[model samples]
Target: MLWAGTAKADYRDSIAVLRIGLVETHVAATDPIKLEAIEHAFSGALGIPVEIIKLGSYAALIDAHASGRVGYAIHSARSFAATEAACGCVRAFRSPVAADGSTGFRSVLVARDSVTLPVAELKVGYSSEASISGWQIPHQAMRAGSLDLPKLVRAGSVGSVIELYQAGEIDGFFGWLPDVPGDAGSDPERLFGGWNRAAIETADPVRIIWSSQRIPYGPHAANRSLPDDLVEALGAFLDQMAVSAPGLLDIFEPVYGGGYVTPDPEEYHNIRGLVEALSDRKSAARIP
Candidate 1:
């Protein structure tokens, strides 16, 4: 039976029947039967009865997590950050690595030519304030660096941002580059994302002038209220699945097929800060 009840008196006891929560938006593309099979496989691997709970929205999932109604959750980076800010009661044990050997992507300022201008003097095009790579991450990075803010032009879309840069309307545009850790942007094989495509196709040479810290992929996190042993078992199961059970790995995380790895405690620090800042802004806006 699906467990959607309120938090138990002792959250530790709730793990008797492990419940994994995910939002419908995250799994809407997957088949229900496959999800059921995945649940069964997870139960077998972890040696416990596992139920996959699908919430209507992230808000509900966050509330459920905060209340200890859900022991574990599959969260997008933003949602995970919001959850962390809400309760400080969960920890991400494992995060997916991209097939390209990247843990995540970084927001970068790609210029038509080598940029020698001060950040405040350069006109940079961004897709929108809502875009993580195009505006939010890069904007936060600039503020953290104590650099004077650049002249940000809203281009509405990545394509438009590229066009504005090409037309000389903006000196550069905010885009993303794969976060391959040690490997700099020199490796042609590691290139990914829309901006990389623009750099390749455009006749003019484009160079990445600035980049933000790696923004990790969404993580599979567990509520700290659960028993430590349980969390470790779940982490082990996922971490080893790419080799022991490739099919289940594909079913569980189709997009990032490289496998799961233990998350660096600081992996989501920047994102959490960003979420808290945004939350504060909204709260301030709501005040009279």
Candidate 2:
């Protein structure tokens, strides 16, 4: 946990020793299992333990990385945005696959199967405004599809939206991801069905329609506080792990690709557009 160095280092070695931030998992470098597997993959190559650091929420984790307490963050979409924009201490790593891998998350519009109606005929209830899938992606889809959601679906908290959906309070529910909102993965807690199920699962009978294109995946950003040379060295280390410890990589699933790539915002062009347009909409609504 403190520092893992089984042997002395040589200048010729491509790996640079460093620790992984907590919240990854509790496991020893000699043996990293399941989701915690990433901890030691970095450890073995870097020739160090990569202390595991844990945080409370996405916001807390971003704060830690931005402050330079951690070298990098494998994080969700918006929090990553807030971190880069605020501290400039972090940069994203290019990923091979999106979080959910490739196709990414999709937006789902739900309605009671008991009713046969056009999207315009039903009042739609959407998840939390703070969420990308709940509010952001749906909003974008509405605009792009030339549908006026504000006039049809009511925007509210996620729980409220679900309640409305079941109550017949709203004719339909607008949810991102039939999977997750933009650049996010499934929350087994928030999502239900078989272990293999995806997106908007529920105890109630609700029919859904595709509302938007697939959402993008996100990256774990490196700390800008590190020296450029060290960053480059770390990247090399990750590249090696892709092949050397692919089994470990497999456990992380959808999170890590073959190896680290340059984290670019352009990979998430649609997400960026959604954020900008949403910001503008909220700002406009605030105007007197």
Candidate 3:
């Protein structure tokens, strides 16, 4: 029986195999290839045979982590908080730096050039109700005014939502804007880059009307049920990768930068609070 994450030096000697859970993200389509590289890098570096488990959703991944079916997982800070709150999974390390050499990302509300902000009501698109960047954070920002979530179209992914908006299928869409330079601070234009920037510069432009608070980089979380020795070893291996094998970290979808670091629980304090607040709001709204 392979009791995952219990090996010492030569993992082959133990019946245990290292099972790594990858959080499915916008880049999920390429997970198999990325995870293959990850398996090779980690197995070679740590002498442990690794098995990669790709989960389809954050909720599914979190449930698996809580049940011990997953030994470790990659997740956004919001997901990390939720997992910790639910199953005591703790952050093993911070993800590599993103584009713009920052460790944080932001969410934005974008619309066709014809649309403007503070419009009383218009069709809006969201990735999913559970998405931190696509829904939760953006929803919190919208709640500051007359924006009502129920009126928002629940598009499946950031790309899909943006597509609907571009096609004039929706008025605006909430989506993640990666690599927002921390130095840019609250500058709206600087924060809008990548495809959004392209749209802004092109003939048919898009407007970034709202930007969410900076979200800390995602984290690598370890299940609490794993042995202490294995946990320490995993951390050590990650630290080694941060220094010695950074390219392998491309699997994490870091937009701008790369390199792991010890995660500070304090880094996620604000995000956790925001998530809790949103949860409370949802529960309250559900009371009929």
Candidate 4:
């Protein structure tokens, strides 16, 4: 859709208003206020009036992207991989660095400091059966160790699982930690950037009993249906935010830490494999 500098077509004729979809996967802010803040940053950077679409289900968000119901989405690596496979969506910009100044995070099994229980006997809480860090990675970890999935007490959200663990309702929960690598920092906000820290830390002193391999953060993906010029412009607008207003990066929930960077779609190949495996497991579970 490129044209001569002065011959550029007006985007308004094709779409009424630009739409950006945000998924409520791990974060705690369920209100519209968080969405509005994100809209402000993007509007300021792109000079485009944007509408916010808050999608609660990751699957629904991917379907929306594939169908072109929305042009952009701040997606999880697992969800992004699925959408890319389904509709050829491409990554525009990687997520800002996490609190530890790292581009990736890890999934962990957390429990209260005082609790002392065998891994197989503990009552475990998972955010959802569909969550990657909260469920998938942790499940795979258990299987690798010949450990069972533990008692199934699904909280439906990371915030909920942490709350349950703190209340002593469950012995432990599977969640995330910042990919600090050689650095050891335990700030929950830095560990899980997008969600509210206060909402996540229900226990005074929680400890990680298990940690998974590094999981890369999600990216801003554009649907294949978008014009090349518009896609390039959108990517440029995000790159500008990293330099001009890095602090504004906080407006994008679930994304905290370093500035944004351009990402190759291949970066998510490993995650896509995990998502595909999880899908197969789910299908097998349904057969019985």
Candidate 5:
């Protein structure tokens, strides 16, 4: 039942984080309100207290869930892989449907100034293990543009990419789209540029040079010890959150596309395969 979040405690704080055995915390990914909604919906569906956990970021979510410290999770495709690989009590349950009504979201190559550029020429930056967006999608998009990647770098997160761009360390980068706005303005259009409801699109300020085909988002998962009925009910509750189609669209609009769909683990095999291929390529390249 222990969820993940950072430990910054004051004696006066009611919800003390120190109580949880937190390894670390990262930047908050999804908003707190949205998280509350998700937790409530899951609780209503499962008819259980359903201790909701907050993860700092994708990596933290992956690590905690993978390590079994946190039993359940809804995380990015890449994070899911890391968790699945973590042992102890790690596995995947479901991937959210894309806002476009697909199994997953698309990867867009973006320039820092928000300008469009040749997908291939831009030195795409990504997490060391961005299975879908960083590697497969960008690589595929680059090939489509008939441009070979000039240089590929491994960055820790989007913030790192922004820093690099500001420092002129890299021209442009490609990575996974987020589920919320870019955190730029009050309107929430600045972050993912309000592309949360669908795949990343080309804007006047930023050009979407290349976009990979849609892929499944993340899974609604729990520890291996979780009873089968609980998992099924949790998924059902998430599915039930849509009392009205319009009500459901609220979540969909952010990530882009139609609305939430059922989880599909098999669909991720393509992404998994791509990661394996990338490892092989990297190994071959390293061989003198």
Candidate 6:
């Protein structure tokens, strides 16, 4: 919440130590020495005793933060949204910016150039219902735009979707493109991950028919119960590290190693809404 200002030491009176939660599966395989080095670095920066609590799973990490057991956490976008929905007790302060200035990715509907049908008439294939970019984002975008829902097929996996599209079994498929800021057009060269790259490379003469809004990367969030000054201090320390101690960022978040940037408040709110809607739909479908 506090973006700028001198952080006061008043939090020391109420807090003895700060704890950060990380899911074990989320981190790379590393030795205890590296973990200790991270703790030491954070302690030195915060001027307080800092502890890293590695939980067995994301659920545990979410519960720990929701219950105020940990003061901070590195979360995936979905986990952070779930944590926010659980207690509304956390605030995402920073998220990683990719080396190419990409903050996130957009779900895109890519069709073969030969397909001349309207979007509503195209036979679109998605990886699965569980896929965010492949299914949810594009589905949500279509609903939001009041477009007629296309005939959708679940391809079981991204590989299958690509295979189907390449074989002309489907007119198009949903994939993701890197969300570079201020970019009005989609570039095949800027695909987010290998899946999109694979889709583009193997299926030539493709065009983006539709695209969703940017879906930001996950964030490092602080518990709302933490003191305002402490939160501000944490934010400042992280922002400073992006410039001074980028190696530390690599250790903490190797996926997006560029740097940390303050996230827009609404970034995860949209994710939360989508998650909740998906949850509700599943719940309703189960009522027999």
Q: How many residue pairs clash in each candidate?
A: 0, 14, 3, 2, 26, 0
Number of the top-ranking candidate, with lDDT as the measure = 6
lDDT by residue for model 5 (33-139), tens = 65455445444444454455665667677666766666676665655555564453645655555443345555666565554455445665665554556666666
TM-score versus the correct structure, for each prediction: 0.86, 0.58, 0.64, 0.61, 0.50, 0.88
Please give the ranking of all candidate structures by lDDT, highest first, separated by commas: 6, 1, 4, 3, 2, 5
The TM-score obtained by model 5 is 0.50
TM-score of model number 6:
0.88
Model 1, runs deviating above 4 Å: 1-14, 28-30, 185-200
- Write one digit per residue (lDDT tens) for candidate 2, span 202-243: 535566554555544566567865656666666676566557
- Model 3 spans > 4 angstroms off: 1-15, 23-37, 107-131, 141-182, 202-212, 227-229, 251-257, 273-288
Rank the models by TM-score, top first. 6, 1, 3, 4, 2, 5
Model 6 pairs in collision: none
Model 6: per-residue Cα lDDT over 1-288, one tens digit each: 574775754887788889999888755325577678788888888788988888988889999999999999999888899899989899999988877777888888887888889988999888888888887777777777755588998999988887887787898888888776788648755543654565657775778888777789989999999998888888898878777887777777778867778999889876897878877888999999
Candidate 3 lDDT tens digits, 1-288: 576866644435552677777755645335567767877876776577778787788878878777778778887677788777775656545465654666676777766667654544767888788687777776665565534443578888766775676677787767666543436544435423455554434334556666666667877777766666666677787767645776765544454345666666677775776667867888999999
- lDDT for model 2 comes to 0.58
Model 2 lowest lDDT segment of ten: 190-199
> Against the hidden true structure, what lDDT does model 1 obtain?
0.79
Task: Tell me, by TM-score, which candidate is best.
Answer: 6
* Candidate lDDT (C-alpha), each: 0.79, 0.58, 0.66, 0.71, 0.52, 0.82
Better model by lDDT, 1 or 6?
6
Indicate the worst ten consecutive residues by lDDT in candidate 4.
Answer: 185-194
Worst 10-residue lDDT window, candidate 3? 184-193
Please give the lDDT score at residue 20 for candidate 4: 79
State the lDDT of candidate 4 residue by residue for 22-137, as single tens digits.
Answer: 77653523656766766777676556788877777888899888888888887878889888777665554556565547767778776667777767777888888778778878
Which residue pairs of candidate 4 clash?
Answer: 97-258, 194-254
Name the regions of candidate 6 deviating beyond 4 angstroms.
1-9, 28-30, 142-147, 194-199, 282-288
Alpha carbon lDDT at 99, candidate 1? 84
